[model samples]
Target: MRIRATAAAVSITGVLALSAFAVPAAQAADAASGKAAFSSASADATSGTTTTSTLDVTFSDMKVNNGKNIAVGTTNVVSVPVTYTLTHPADMDTSSDHFASGPLIYRGSSPDTASNMLISDDPATCTATSSTTMSCKGVIYVRPADGDLMNADAGTWNAGALAVDDSGDHTMQGGLGTTKVQRYSKLTANAGPEPVVKGRTITTTGKLTRANWEDNQYHGYTNQPVKLQFRKAGTSTYTTIKTVYSDSYGNVKATATAQYDGYWRLSFAGTTTTPAVNATGDFVDVQ
Candidate 1:
């Protein structure tokens, strides 16, 4: 099952300490004893020193979602893949059960004080490449319905990594890289009349819409410029005929002289919060 860290839990400095050691429900019973001990040790360690400690560990070559924008719809859960290289002291055994690590993406300046964050549901799986080097892979799950994302959260997010040892010592690092989270966008076009006299005015209409995380629905992306293009029926080329801006209701309309049989469509250039989209061409016949 996919799990999310609550805002209250993730906003604290010990966020990584708790998340790094999280266990799946199925294994909770068996891990209960170990978890309790780790919690106690963590409390004792925090009482003696600051949470952020310099450790002989570093994360590099970190990549999130294969370096592409993460577009998420309203209902479907989005699973993002993350991979990174971890370098640590030769004596630190990262693959042991006593060690845990994971990657996270957040919108705020720092991971510890992030207003919104996404983290892997489980600890990363690491394979040893040498005594002190390893390759790690993990998945971060985003569920929009669970309030995991808001429309405002769509944009550039900073990547971060964290690791915790058996003794509750932990380190968190941010600014490793960055990734974009976009709202899925949709566009539609329709041209009429189906068969019109040569040189007659052909009206093309369309709408630009994008996912709204707040309501789990697609709403008008108003006041955005969209391109209207035409493709000759027999040819494979589409030339821009004109540029139209979406109205207050996200509706776009344009008129063109129909001189030949062709298809008409609308193309949106997109923005930081939304991905570019093209409407399937609507065919029109000229008599």
Candidate 2:
């Protein structure tokens, strides 16, 4: 929402040209963890009954350059200010987009600019085709293909669209409810054996539930191979369990048995035909 520089407790200056700063050394942080937390939805309304028939949003990775020779540390929380301009829905003029600078899931150049910056409606492609009409989805790419550490060589950072569908309130009936929607722009990448278990250090146990994938209109999780890997607490490595398929309700059942006690993460990827990957909805702490 607001873009401002946050000072990390220490600032190293003058050693390098003010604009000649180095990119922070990549750490062992997990991008999947950051994405799962950022790509969530929120709804609001008041008084007579305001409804959001649709909501679309795009995202990008968090980017940083110490333009002023500001020394950054390992603990500095980098903020990626995601900007969105909404073309108010025809029936609703009062709507807002929320959440910014909370996580590092997204880290790359954002396509948002003040002149071309917006939340919902897009000038190039929209059904209404007019500036006055509000659009439902946001066309944002949270990160480019290279940004995903898992497969940096791909060099195909892409854009996907999030869309909310036919949902709103009826003043006459006094009923109000909103349905969350998601759409994945197809991606082409090497579809390999499901994510492998990076070797186990500890024992872990948890259930797997799909969040964003289930909402897409094309595929509904039936007969689809979803692979997930986990590790025990205190360890960064992951271990592959069985390759599970999504059930009718778009849910997967998983149980982890790690060799040691520690933290865990489950990484998801589609089969050979579809090459999109998703991370766990929640982190598991194995004690």
Candidate 3:
């Protein structure tokens, strides 16, 4: 079969991020949801007509579909971008209904039941970089009702691909695999006693937490170091004054002698499992 290339880009409405593997025996998503909308296979049937033959797919720099970290109001959309390169001995005619597809599921230490279906909205947009390699960027959405697929703390995940034949009867899967993880966090800060004596101590308190995908809750992120910084009034530079660690409940507290009128804030340097975060500035007046 002769390979033909077209520039078709998938315009997804919205999304989040995550991994891949053998899709469950049942279709993880609804009929019109995710890659399933265009995908024809489920966990039960992901292999080939010729058992020895398989397609080649590689992914790099995968992230939340919208390309942003997890935040309070957001992180609900179900999509992640998989920048990839596809290579196969067989020609992948973009003109055919057959293309790339899979599920972006949670494969962390304990996997989340929810998954995002993978699909290339526009197969034509996928490029033929060479006779045997094609470069493409596609999306996998967490889908309606599914939440936080990539919200793990340095969690482990993967992205799987398959080359569906033109007939759609044969599926050569496990094209390429890559590890996926989520590094996102949240924090809060507050300062009390708006007006204080210059020599008196001011107490600053805050909380640190990351998304808990399994229960969809935000619990305290324990035993993490956080820096307390201060900025004099009308200044843009913030100088670190002290370091503190979150308590068992991810709550943080520290006291500093007030010397000048300014803003005080707490910042978490974060860890491999969580992204760094800075609490909003809390302004205080020194009398």
Model 2, 41-123: lDDT tens per residue?
22221112222222332222212121111111122222222222223335542222211111111112221111111121221
User: What lDDT does the true structure give each of the candidates?
Assistant: 0.77, 0.26, 0.51
TM-score, predicted candidate 1 vs. hidden true structure: 0.85
Query: Each candidate's TM vs. the true structure?
Result: 0.85, 0.25, 0.64
Q: Model 2, stretches more than 4 Å misplaced? A: 1-182, 185-220, 271-275, 281-287
Candidates 2 and 3 compared: the better one by lDDT is: 3
RMSD of each: 4.4, 21.6, 9.9
List, in order, the clash count of every candidate structure.
Answer: 0, 32, 16
What is residue 156's positional error in candidate 1, in angstroms? Answer: 1.0
Ranking by lDDT: 1, 3, 2
Task: Please provide, for model 1 over 113-203, each residue's C-alpha lDDT reduced to its tens digit, 9 standing for 90 to 100.
Answer: 5668787777789889989888999888889888788888999988877676654456667777899999999999999998999989999
Query: What is the lDDT for 273 in model 2?
Result: 25
Query: How far out, in Å, is residue 3 in model 1?
Result: 11
Q: Any residue pairs clashing in model 1, and if so which?
A: none
